[model samples]
Target: MDMQSGTVEEALDKAAAVGVTAVVQVGCDLERSRWAAEVAGRHENVHATVALHPNEAPRIRREEGPGALDAALDEIAALAALPQVRGVGETGLDYFRTGADGIEAQTYSFRRHLRIAKEVGKALVIHDRDAHQDVLRVLREEGAPGTVVFHCFSGDAAMAEECAAAGYYMSFAGNVTFKSAQPLRDALAVAPLDLLLVETDAPFLTPAPYRGRPNAPYLIPVTLRAMAAVKGVDEDELATAVAANTARAFGCPPPR
Candidate 1:
């Protein structure tokens, strides 16, 4: 919402007008992480997460070297300690965007993020794209944090079952409504309601019938409605469950 709307205030206002009570503004790098923390601090309805994106691993390694990557992780750790920063994330494996040579750096960065989240007692937000197996492997190898959320969950039923068994939250985005996303809906069907969450992935994955247009927290209802349909539950019931699940996952109460 901050990236798409005129200002953070405007985004929050718009979201509220459309029934959005709270939002977690995620950051992909140090600069954005700082911005997110600042936003969360000023807005009672907002929280933030800090981490370097998986695709950024190669660039950081190429331009600044491994030492710079370590330094950036250190900065991310510091930012993650902020009171409003409730998670360490947007980190995980992205084989689709990162090449083979960059996998090592990406894995290393992910491990550091896991450690930071654990140290700070925050949730772990994972961005797994075409690397589910590797992501799971790394989390297992490093020992996952108490709360783990798969942001814009892209796994199938089996993977959903695996994550559910491990008590990880699966946050569905607008992509789940795509006509080509039956498999995602299948995963949602099997996902435990207690561990299900909904997000906009705003300004990126707009729901069908509104795809290619800008997305914001206000548009979350569209995704939530679809999820409710998939789960065979009332929209309001699912919303309530997801709200509680989100608060539990991020360790924050809903906005009043």
Candidate 2:
């Protein structure tokens, strides 16, 4: 139920068949980060964003040792410097999964990831969940990088406006198509076209009517169509804007 159905090549081929040509493979740990970079290097249309998941930071400190987290961060920084590594993240707070005990470590890891992104002159991809204000505060305290994307953005309209004001990209995922996601729709409605992006957040958050199915890049069109409706724009127009916005957000060239 958790694993996706096919090989990476198959998924990419299917995605291309459906007009989802480019992808940013995200890594939430050291091993996956290395793999992501390798995959990106192998595939012209794929780019990588590497980071310790917010939850991973606290777990590493608690289980591995205090220094283990920093060592991991150092490796992530190195990976970020690679040409195929377009960003540093999926880093940021995740209060929903991490308890009060883990907050300090999570914040520290997030700040370091921020520094790495800036140092490498790359974009910062945030994975904020139920810690939106704190995530905003941290970015403000650390000074955000040239580009910041709130991956799988879960904020409401007011938050969207704030993000827009700060020139942050809010990337909507398949969950936005859910019937109960009116607030997400509201956020989408207010989000500027230039700041909008779409993602699969694969093997999770499958779009409506396919919620229980394993998600993949091929399903992006479903979410895009829903977002277009919420945004009150023609689907093709929204698609064009999103394609350009994604390239700008990740600092990657648009796919051919």
The C-alpha RMSD in Å for every predicted model, in order, reads: 0.9, 1.5
Compose the digit string of candidate 1's lDDT tens values, residues 1-256: 6564688878777788977889999999888888889889998789999999998877899998888898999999999999999999899999997789999989989999999999999999999999999899999999999999999999999999999999999999999999999999999999999999899887889998899888888888899999999999999999899989989999999667
* TM-score: model 1 vs. ground truth: 0.98
What is candidate 2's CA lDDT for residue 165?
Answer: 100
After aligning candidate 2 to the native by TM-score, how far in Å is the CA of 48 from where it should be? 0.5
For candidate 2, write residues 124-143 as lDDT tens digits: 99999999999999999999
Per-candidate TM vs. native? 0.98, 0.98
The CA lDDT at 190 in model 2 is: 96
Model 1 poorest ten-residue lDDT run: 1-10
